[model samples]
Target: MWNRPRFDLKVRLTLRVAAISAACFAAISAYFLVTADRAAHARSDSIAAIVAKSLELQQGKVQWVANPRSDFPNLDPVAAYVMTPGLCLAFRGPGGDMLQRFCSGAPAPANPPPQAFAAFYRSLFDPGREAARPVVVRGTKLGETVVSVDPAVQTAEAWHEAGRLMLALAIALPLLCVLVYAALARALRPTRMIRTGLERIAANDLTTRLPPFDLAELSAIRDVFNHLAQSLDTALAERSELTRKLIALQDEERRHLARELHDEFGQSLAAIRALASSARQTAAQECPSLLSECDGISRTATGMMETLRGALFRLRPPDVEELGLVASLEGLVAGWNGRSRGETRFSIRFDGAFETLPAAVSANLYRIVQEALTNAAKHAGATKVSLELTMRPDEIALAIDDDGRSNEPAAKSGMGLLGMRERVAALRGRLSFEAGPNGGSALRVVIPLEASDRQLLDHAA
Candidate 1:
C-alpha cells in the first residue's frame, strides 16, 4: 500500500479553507443558539407578568370569597385571553392547594430535532425554568401566576434555525473548495515550465530560459532563472574559448619542440653516422680488425635516429588544414596499420566530404582520433580496429571500435583520455568510452557544428 501523504498545493489549500469555514459556521451557530435561549426566557417572563396583572384586576373588581372551586372567579377567561403557544399558566391558593390551572397546549413540532441536538440544547439552557408572579388584592396574598415556555417548542425552533444555516454551509463549502483548488492550480501552472527549464540546464543547455509569468513570485523566479542561465552560458563560452586557445598553444609548442629536435639532434646524429662510416672505411682499408667496432657505432647511431623520428612524428603530426581532415585521417590509419605490422588491422570509413570543415574543428577531431587510437593500440592491445566518421547536416560523429581487451579503467584515468575529453569539451561535443557487451571497448564522439560550418558543409556536399 502506497500510503504517502499528498503534497499537492491545491488540495491542501482547499482543505484548509474548508476547515476555517466550518469553524466560522460553528461559531455563528453557537451565537444564534445563545441568543435564542435569552429570547425564550424573556418571552416567558413577559407572559407571566401579563397574566398576573390581568388576574389582579379581575380579582379587584369582584367581592372576596373563600370558596375553593365554586367561587374561583372563573379564571378560564383570563387564562384564555392571555394564553399563547408553548405557554402554561397555573394558580395556587395561599394554602398551597391548586385552585385553577390553564395551559395553552404547545403544538408538536412538524420535524423534531435530533436527540443529540435536543440533549445539547437542554444542557446549555434551563428547559424547565418558569416565571412566577404573586397575585395580591386588598393587602391579601393570592395564589401565584406561573408561566413557563415549553422545552420541546424551544428546541424545535432552535433546530429549524440552525438547520437552515447548516444547509447553507453544506452547499457553499464544496463550491468554495473547488474555486480555491482551481485558482491554486492556475497560479502554480508555471512550475511545470520551471521544472523543464531546470532539466534542460542539467543537460548542459544553458540557453533554456523561462518566460515571464503573471504572478509576482513566479515572475521573480523566472527573472532569476534566466539570469542564472545567461551567466552560465557566458561562463561556458569563455571557458571553451580559453580551452581552445590553450590547445592551440600546446600544439604550437609541440611543433617548436619537434622542429628543434629535428634541427639540432638530426644534424648531430648525421655527423656521428658520417664519422662512423668514414672511420669504418679507413679501418677496412688499413686494419680490418677495427671494422666491427666502427660498424657497431654506426648501427647504434642509426637506431637512435629511428627513435628520434618516431618521437617527432608523434609530437608534430602532419598539417590537417593543408591536407584536409579526410586525407589526414586516412594517412593516420595507414601509418597505424604499417606500425602494427599485421598484428592489428586498422581501417577507416568516411561518409561525407570533410574538405570545407573549419580549421579548429579539423584539428580537434584529428587529435581526438589520435588519442583514441593510441589508447586502443598501447593500452587495449586490440587486434582489429575500425574507425567511422559520419557527417550529418547538424553534427559529426566518430566511432572507434576495437576487438581487444577492455581498458575501461585505464581510459577513465589516462592522460590521453583526459586530453580527448578536453578537446571534445572545447568543441562543445560529447564523448563516451565503454566496454562492448561481448568483447573489447568502443569510443564514440559527437560534435555539433555551428550554423556557419553546417552551411559550408551543406554547400560543399
Candidate 2:
C-alpha cells in the first residue's frame, strides 16, 4: 500500500545524484562567469587602444592639411584612416570646438566627450552588465571626434555564443548524471539481492540461502549466516533427543516404583493376614501353636518394616544429610563388598578435604560411586576392584577399576551406561568408561568445584 513504509533504493540513489549534479553545475557556472568577464574586459581594452591610435594618426593629417603653406596641404586625413578606408566618425580639433565633422550617414556627433573618455565609458562596455562594446573617439587637434558603437548589436552576437555554451552544459551534465547512476546501481545490485534474501528468512525458512555472492567481503557474511542457521538446527536436534530420553527415564522410574511397592508391600500384607487368620482359628481351641504363630507374625511384620525403610532410603538416602558423604560412601562400599561373591576384592581409598565439600557435591559423588559399584558388581565379571575418591585443587575425582575383561563393547542402548552418562552430565562432570590395564572396565569421573557454584551452595546451606 502507498501508506506503508517502503525501502525503495532508487530514491536514495537519486538524492545523492542530484546533490552531486547541483554542485558540479554551480562550479561550472562560476567558472564561466569569471572567464567571460575577463574576456570581455580584454576585448574592451583592445578596442580602446585601436581607437586611440586611429585618432592620433588622423590628428596628424588634419594638422598638415590645415597648414596650406606646408607640403602636401591638399592631402585628405580620410586617406590615412586604416579601418574602412574612411573614418566611421570624425572630429575637428583637440580643444572641443569641432571645426568639422564627418560620418558615413551616421548621426551627427553629440557635443563632445569628457576629457577622460576611456574612464567615463568603461562601465558601458563591461561584460557583466550587458553584451555590448561602446567605443569613443576624440580628436587631439580640434579636440575631438566621438562615436558610440551601439553595443546592443555587438552583444547580440556574444549572447548567441553564450547560449551555445549553456545549451551544451545543460545537455551534457544530465547525460553524465545518468551514466553515473547506472554504474552505481550496477555495482550495488548484489547488495540489494542479499537484503531481499535476508528479509525472506524466518524460523520456518532456515534452509533458505542468500544468492551466491562471489565478492570476498560479501561471501564472509553469507558464510556466517549459514553457520548460525546450521548451529541452531543442530542444537534443536540435540534438545529433541534429550527430551525423548528424559520421557523414557521418567516412565522407567514410575515402573520401578510400582514394582517395588507391589512386590515388597503386597507380600508383607498377605503374609501378615495369613498369620493373623491362623492365630484366630487356634485361639478358640486355646492351643500353644496359635501363640507361636502370633509371635512369628510380630517378627515378620518388624522385618518387613525394616526392608521397606531400607528400600525407601535407597531411593533417596536420608543418610546423605545426617552422616555426610564420607560415612555414607564407606557404608555403601562395605555393604557391596560383603555381598559380592566373586574373587573381585573391593578396595576404597580417599585423599584431601572430604569433610568440607558442599552437601550437593557430596550427594552427587556418593550417587556416582554407588552406581559405579553396582555396575561393576552386575556386569564387569571382574575378580578384583579398586576405588579411589579424591579431591584435587578445585576439583573432585572418582575412579573405579576392576580386574576382569570390560563390557565396553555393549550396545549404546544399554540404559546403565546411558544413565551414568546422564547423571554425570547433570552434574556438569566428565565421565569415561573403558578397558583398564588388566582388561576390566574402568569408570572415572571428575567434577570441578567452580567457585561460583560453591558460593551458591554455601549460601543455600
Per-residue C-alpha lDDT of model 2 across residues 88-186, encoded as one tens digit per residue = 333434344544444333333333333353233345444223212222335213243333333332344344444556677688767866777787777
* Residue 5, model 1, lDDT: 82
Candidate 1 residue runs with Cα over 4 Å from true position: 1-6, 41-159, 189-203, 207-219, 262-314, 322-355, 369-392, 397-421, 429-446
- The estimated TM-scores of all candidates read 0.68, 0.40
Q: Which one is best on lDDT?
A: 1
Off by over 4 Å in 2: 1-310, 341-344, 408-413, 454-461
Backbone clashes, candidate 1: 0
Cα-based lDDT at residue 161, candidate 1 = 92
Q: Residue 159 in model 2: shift from native, Å?
A: 82
